[model samples]
Target: MSERKRFYLTTAIDYPNSRPHIGTAFEKIGADVQARYRRMEGYDVFFLMGNDENTVKVARRATELGLATKAYCDEMAQQFQDVWRALDISYDYFIQTSDPRHHEGCRKFMQLVYDRGYIYAGTYRGWYCEGCESFKTETEIKEAGGVCPVHRTPPVERSEPCYYFALSRFQPALLDYYERHPDFIQPEPRRNEVISLVQSGLQDVNITRIGQDWGIRVPFDERFTIYVWFDALLNYITGIGYGWDEERFREWWPADIHFIGKDITRFHCALWPAMLLAAGLPLPRRVFAHGWVYIKNEQTGAVEKISKSLGNVVEPMEIITKFSSEAFRYYFMRECPFPGDGEFSWSRFAEVYNADLANNLGNLYSRVITLILRHFEGHLAGSRAWEPGEIYEEQDLEATVQQVQGYIENCEYQLALQRIWQYILDPANRYADRKEPWKLVKQDLEAAARVLFDLVESLRVTAILLKPFLPRTAERIYRSFNFSRDWQQVRCEDCYVYPRPVDDLRCLVRPGPDGKLAPLFPRIEIR
Candidate 1:
């Protein structure tokens, strides 16, 4: 057998300074879907996610709570894990920057660059934004009215002894890399932004901070701590056994993709790649910067960023509880376009949940099962008449499989779902309406059997297609048919061809013993 193609993917680790919001969860969910799809396609995949705990912010928060920094991080790490667990994120490993392995790996990686003559000691003075944990340019400060663009807080001016990375040395090399691989950064617009910034000129960046004791001690100088960005970026490789396990590291060193929020594009696209080049390591194949989740301000009727100060923070768990996790996943995937920012409103969310899940998907399943039990007395006698020869041919099911695959490959999740919902689900429902299987049973028994058979098989294919998106709901629909004994795996087969042993309807869709099945998603009344 040929070697399995290796694929390593990651999402930017969370800061763990606060409870994660829906915006944070959005990146995780998107990455998880991509990972699931790759696994289905038979790639050897490793997905990594983690938390960034080596920050002065953690120490500050600890002081407020009268706890040690490590103690606070331990507690906060659990909180972050709880959110990931709730979302059913399928990450292979979760790396904490505070981990001993990570510290050793980061120090080793830094030393490799230093020995290469890419790092040097220097004294630096600049305006530092504590919220961002980076020095801001004068232009950036002025644009935000003398405050940090993201936090709206004034930066503190500080002069300190530091170690700087010679990122300036890689200016030509970076431009050349971009020229050779135009697709390094996604969405074209982000690529243009990174290119423009690099072309303007490159500057050496401060890699170690002075008089800060809350983080990993610089290897050569114990008095200083590694800067948060430098430390956090190392987790991507260190989590995969980079420093210690050469054999394993070689297996998946160059990540296939790094998914991050748009705000951090500068670091991931420019700084991180330059650091890797300095270490004589391969750059990650791609960096995708996804947009934020903007929520509406209730009183002003204006869109606003979701933040603590605005009190516009949405509690993801509250929404997940009210609407199941399946609905939550479907809403975000279907409603949010991946390339652009997504808007969130309680009214829009409720509207989508009721219309798509409860009305479209839930109603279709309930109607199909209910009619089979009522008219056929839980027995479907499979005959040649039931074969969906022309109907299947008309649906062009093969093309749909290709369409969905293409959309996923390009990370166009919303488009893929829209095709499934509009083309697949809507057409199947309309077929039911045209045949009127309930009425057809009295007019022509064989004709009615054919209609129900087509509907049942269509649903089977839909459940398979839906697995990576709404896993729980898909399995529930699958089990309702009682064919759990037939197919042990969740996979997509040729749309027109049914998985065989189709001699009996009872074999395909076994009706519940009581001729009744529970509702999939009960309609919720919007107050």
Candidate 2:
């Protein structure tokens, strides 16, 4: 009965040059998990994701395809959204940087920062990577042995007339801000890296590019277009009615978290906040720099970045089609550590799927539901009086819920899932094995009913905890029983803090053509 607090989060907009790989989807899935968790905690959440279309690659790729620039961006945007939707990324808005409103807002913001003396005209000569569409600093080039770290290719030296943002001027202020807010850059290692970079020195960055007409133009000078990074970063504000809807923008301007990849922490944590400070806007509360998803060379036992040249890039849709949205979500969130690097291999995927989902969680669900349906015709007598026992004997219910909550709040997704399986669900499976509920039904009818009640309770608890991570599967699990509360209305703390009592206590899931409830997670065959 209190007002729901607001939570706004955004992921880095991807370049529309190519289809998104599993590596790209990794970041979105992590952000979606957090967004869903916040909603479950009763926050008014807004999730934003999009494509960065105002880059040189956009036009070049479009030209290669023989399509007009805008048409290409539109088509790619649809393709990107389709993949994200199919993966069940619950983003509220998808901003295309080429939108008229985005262009208008970017121009206005640039002009404001320009008038404030942070912007100046200059000539920039630096190592440039055409793939990333940005200038690389000497430090970056040297560390990576005279190549752009991301592209892993030598950056061309070029000179161009441009407008620069006076980022060096904010050096002292940025350091102070970091000192004051240690939590601004998440996962400790990223925070230290950002601090070290800013402490080394800040450089005034080129904000406008000449001889480019595909991007938003610098308002005062029509001859130059805005740099893609500068333009792309504005998506967070512009996507949420920044220049157009003042009332709406004010409500969500200072985002709770900017969910970006570890590669772009410098952009989000340093350049982004400085730009906001220049415009006198509040910075986003936190920037979470999540790790990458690499492809494991199963034979060689080596791990490498997902790249087309490497011939190891795995598309998100490839796995989503092969399995399911929930299965896709579960594999990454379970196998991959959220704040660190993870590897994906077909054999590893099958192993995790069968061990965690099929053998443990799904197997438990089928046996419990089937046993209840077969013996009691899907109704358990006096289930309302059933004192649902502990899913974990070592910890009480509230303590158990708190432990999972702590992992989620810190974005320790893999750990949270491990806790669920190892503590909550594993114990439930153990309980079934220990009691042998199926055999009890043949002799001790009343005792068997009690055992089924506890198993069903375990499933209910499991569903509530998994709702945010594995949404569709969670809904299916929750809807199988006649829980008193509505599925959507359920919250993370509901499992312990205020568990609603069961009512009719009858199986609500529809039986398949085989006259039996289908398996929630069918065992994946390892070929």
Candidate 3:
């Protein structure tokens, strides 16, 4: 077998201005799935996430909340950690930009760029928003609107002496990087956007903000601190010990993927690679920008963006409490393609939960287990000496298995799941139609055992493939069959081990009238 490649993945470090919503949660979950899948494939994986804590937005929010900036950021950061935990997000490192180690790494990176002649000093005159902490051009700002588009607050016009990075110096190099590495920014639309922006022109970007005492001090000048993007973007490198530990840094630099929201694509796709090139560091392999979720009125077809001010923001915790984290994860991925907009509605959520989880998967599991319990005294039948199956069944099952592997490898999880369910439905229909068990109870007990064994083996395969998405549900199914629940313990090609019959085996989920029904997903009435 060939050696497995190492994988490094990251989510955009969230700005800790407020608690995260479902938008941020989706990105984290997507990265988590990718990391978990890589690990399952025997690849070394590093998944990094953290808060972007150094910004005028954070500082002002801290003051408004009547606490020191550090304390305020610390408090908000905890909310992110709590949300990640509730969602069962398995990250290798949860890095906070406020950590002293990160501070040291950021400083070292800045020093490297400065030594390369990419750094200069200049005075910036533009529409500055204390809320955004960035200079915005007049054309970029809305003419009729007083507030910033992002922060939705008024801008503060100011001029200050600051350290600047000669971004124009890397224009040719950045364009070349894009030409050579077309996959660096994902989805043709977003990549074309970046290309057009780069070709239009580049400008010298201010790297430091004067009077921002809350941020890291510039190496030579106490009056200036690193700009928000320059400081925040470094979290990806610093979190992995970019400058502090040479050996550790070498292990996971140049992330395989950086999953970010569409709004911040420019910072990650355009500026980040340019900085890495200037410093002779590796550029990220790919940057995927996902679309925003919008809330729409069912009757009027009116759509509005989800946000705090609009009172439409869907909190991560609220969704987790209402539905299992697995359900939330599955719904988001299945509802839309990875790179496109997806609409969210209470009705749509209910429909997916009831149809996919409760009715299809959960209901099928209950029926199979219940039949095993009722017919064979609640214990799986003994393994019978086997014979080869009909060519059609064997071929169909092999095809489905191969499809499962393909979808997962390509990161098309929804398709993977659809394929797994196909295995379940096909077997369930075959078992019901055979009626071989009824005839075997008297004269053909061995034939009955063979039929039942095939069903149980199908369940085992389903459980193994479904673990990454619905871990808890998969575990329950494994326990119902009295089989080992650990994915590492079972090989995909291994024949299912028939558990010795136990008199007290019970169904994990009760079934309904169509079979034996249980409420895997109880109806949730949203307020």
Candidate 4:
């Protein structure tokens, strides 16, 4: 047998100036789903997540909190990891920019780029937005009426001596690279925006700023700190052992995917690749610029960007505390298109949770288990063993499974979930409604057992499909039955094809005192 392919994946490192909000959580969740899916597909996956601690804004926030910079960064990194763990993010490693390993790797990278002759001493005069921790182009400022549109504050005009990255020198190479690898920047709209920007022109960017104690310093120029973006983007390499571990670095250098927010597409697509080119390193396979999660204004019913100025920053913990992490995961992956923007509101969340989880999935699980336990003692006859096809005979099972696999491969998570519901869950729920297996138990006990078997088969198919999106919920469903395939060993192929007939299918779940499996998702009241 051949070896499994290594899949190195990462999400954009977030600033630890504040705790993570839902908008921040969205990108992580999207990346997590992909990582989980890849693992299920037999890839040796390395999922990396982290905090961007080296920033002016972070230092300022630390001072206001009356804590040392390192202490503040450490505390917030824990808080960030807490939410990720609570949501069941299966990241292989979490790297902090403030860590010694990262600092070492970052310095080595700076020196490599410098020695490659891409660095030059220069002076810059531009509009600098401290909130963004970067200089803004005049067009960007003018378009926003001289204010940073995101921060809603005027950018200060600043002039300082700094070191430059010869980004403009890489324009031809960048354009050629984009043309050769059209799939490098994902989601057609984002790819178009990046191509247009490269066609316009490339500008040499300032890679260093004078004397900041909180950030990584330029290796050759000790008097200056590396610019935050220049430092921040290096986390992708530093986390993977760019300088420290040669073997590990070579193994995972060209990331399978760099999942980032759409706001920073330009940097990842243009500047990041150029930096890699200068250092003679391979470019990441793909940079997927996933969209933002907006807030549905309850009063106005308009979806607006979740921002501090709007006073609508909803924390991930709030949702997790109120509902199960499974509910939080399902809602976002089902409602929000991963490649495009999605809106969130308490009302919408409740509606989806009730309709999808409680009514359809939860109700089906409870009804099927209760039927078997009540009339037949939770076991089908030991003599009964049948092929999976004999159970799910009505549907073109393989075709539907292939469709979902395709949707998932393309990162069309919302559509993938929708298709599973429409073709699989919805049909099962409707079958339950029409068959009324509870009522059939009275008429033909033998015939009713057949219906129960069919419904349970539906649950099996669903558990496999939902594994990546809702890991906990899927396992709960799969482990409830004594199936031929092990819960951990199952994959997309197992949905339609099986090794042998299901032998003496019996429920493995223990019931409560009342002799009933508990509801997976108890309905939530929005108020």
Candidate 5:
């Protein structure tokens, strides 16, 4: 047997300022899809997600709640975990910046750069955005009236003694790296943005703050604490056992991909590479900066960021509970363009959920099995008995699989799903309508059986393709048709196998008299 390929992936650790909303859930869900896809392709996938707990926002939130910083972080960590669990995120490890191992890893990284003369003592006097946890240059602050543009609030001006990393030394190297590896940052637009920023010039970055007591303390200088970004960025490596387990760290070092939001691309693509270069570490292969999620407010009829402060945050759990997790996952994956901003509206969500999941896919599955019982006494003929014919020949299963795979490789998740639905599911539904399998049965049983078999084959292929995107639903469909429930054994080629009635699956209904039916996605009625 050949060796199983290894894949390492991570999402930007979230700052636990509040409970997760739909916006934050988007990143976790997107990363989860990628991890699932890699696993389906038989890779040894390690997906790391985490909470950035060293932020001043967490400290402030804790103070407001009259809780200790650690206590607050612990609570917030659980909240984040709850959201990820509810969303069915399959991350291998979830690291917290406040973890002792993470602190050790960050200190070790700092020491490595310091030993190389890439870090030095310095004083920083600048305008800081507490919300962003980064200093904003005058040019950035100007458009927002001396405030942080995203938060729409004035920054706190501070002067402090700090330790600085020699980021200025890596401008030429970073530009060259970007040129040599054009795909280092994804979505072309993000790469262009990073290139422009680097061409402007780079400056040394402050690595530690003197007055923060709630963050990781510097290894050498105990008086200062590590900056949030400096400490938080290391969690990606720390989660994989960077400080304590060299063997494990080396196994997955040089992550295959880093999935982050667009707002922070500069930090991940620019400063992160410089830090790794200083420490003589290999850089992550790719950084994909996905766009933000906007919610269309019903009252104002205007789109806005999904934020608690704006009183417009949509609770992810509420949606997950209202609709099945499959519907939740499908809507986001289908509606949102992976590389661009996506709008979320209850009306739109309901429409897409009903149209795609309930009406299209669910109806297709129900109709196929229903027709099978109506025509063939609840029995499906094996592939050997069913000769190939026209209704199925036009689907082109191989080309559809190749097209979806190519789109996935390019990180075009929306496009990948769109193509699958268009080429496979939609075509199956249309074939059912065009063939009128119910009508065919009265005139000719064999011809009708062939049509039902064609539809069943299409569904099997779709289930295999849908495994990574909608795992639970895929398993349900597979088992409903008497296929093995062992998902790991589910391969694209299996779709070609014709299945007959199995004793264990007899409890599932057929389409004729006394035949019961279950809707994959039940239609929702809006109040």
Candidate 6:
């Protein structure tokens, strides 16, 4: 037997200061899809996700809401869990930075680095955003009045004695790591950005901040709380039983991929790795920084960034309610490549769903199943012997199966779905144009049986390939055929073995009267 491949993946822990929006949900869904795909491919996969609760942002938001910081964070963290469940995210571990285990892990790691002489206490002056819980350089500070850009609030100039990590000490080591692993930071553009930043220079980063009572207290220094980013980044290890379960830690440590948004690329790709190197831990294998979602105005066609302050945040629950969780997931992944920005338009979503899901995919399945029951007495027909010259059907199935394998392996899910649909479309068009059932009952029963048998096999193949993306739909398709089993075991070639019949066919998407249907995708009118 071949050795089992191992994959440990994670999405950036979301800050619990505010409720999550589509952007955060997108990252989780994307990472979840990849993890599921890996598991289907027979890999030992561990996917981690969690909340970043140790920040002044949470404290300030709690203060604004007139609640204690822990209470506010706890409430917000539940919201995160709700969204994840609604989205069907399958994370192996959902960590919270406020967990006692996390605090212990953070302290231990900090102490290890401190004992290694990488951390020192010093007074540093800088522009600070209590809302962001991090210091900003002159250039990083956007507002002329010293307001935090993200919060749109003024920041105070602060000076305090805090524990600082000698990030500069690992500059050469980081450069060497990058040199050895070219794909460590992914999508080529992000890797180049990291390289440029590392080549430019490095600075010692403040790992602890004084006068912040909302975060993990620094080891041996209760006067200073560990900085938000530093404390939050440790969740990756803390969630995997680091500093507790040595065997479990050894099993999933050094994550295979760290999926993060472009906005926080610097923290994950730059600072986090330096911290890991300092602690003598293996670094994450890759950091993939994905871009944002742009919401375009319906009438003007002008695009704007998604922001809560602008009241333009598109909630995933709202979309899932309007459409479906599967549709929402399919649209997001299929609409854009992983690394590029995608525009979310109501019109575009309607077009894709109506054309792809409602009409092409759903209609095709319904038609095939309906025809099978009508023509074969509500049962699948036996496989007839192929004529001496008939090899095209077998060859075509083989080629399409190969295409499915390649498309999924490359993470081109849209292309994979299209390839499967192409097989369905070809036979569907032939069945419609030829009217095989009508022609065969009178003229040739064997010929019509052959056509229907081929169609059934094609439907089975389509459902199997679609299991990863549209699991619910795939299950419906499988149930329509009286098979209830994992999709991985079902192969197109194996469909020939079971010469069974399917009865009691139902419309996957029932069409309305007048031989017409209402628009499958209604426009999104945000209230």
Query: Candidate 5 local accuracy as lDDT?
Result: 0.83
Candidate 5 vs. truth: CA RMSD?
A: 2.8
Colliding residue pairs in candidate 3: 147-153, 510-517, 510-518, 511-516, 511-517, 512-516, 512-517
lDDT per residue (tens digit) for residues 102-204 in model 3: 8888888888888988888888887887766788767677763866778767787888888888888888998898999988887678899999989988888
Q: Which whole-number lDDT from 0 to 100 does residue 395 have in model 2?
A: 42
Off by over 4 Å in 5: 374-377, 382-389, 392-395, 484-486, 493-515
Best by lDDT: 4
What CA RMSD would you report for each candidate?
A: 2.4, 1.7, 4.3, 1.6, 2.8, 4.5
What is candidate 3's CA lDDT for residue 296? 67
Question: What global local distance difference test value does model 4 have?
Answer: 0.90
Query: CA lDDT, every prediction?
Result: 0.82, 0.89, 0.74, 0.90, 0.83, 0.74
Q: Give all TM-scores, in the order shown.
A: 0.94, 0.97, 0.87, 0.97, 0.94, 0.87
Worst-scoring 10-residue span by lDDT in model 4: 385-394
Error of 6 at 426 (Å): 6.2
Ranking by TM-score: 4, 2, 1, 5, 3, 6
Residue 94 displacement (Å), model 3: 0.9
Which candidate model has the greater TM-score, 4 or 5? 4
Q: Looking at model 1, report the run of 10 residues with the lowest lDDT sum.
A: 383-392
Error of 3 at 240 (Å): 0.8
Against the correct fold, how does model 6 do in TM-score?
Answer: 0.87
Taking all chains together, the TM-score of candidate 5 against the true structure is 0.94
Off by over 4 Å in 6: 1-3, 142-155, 384-443, 482-527
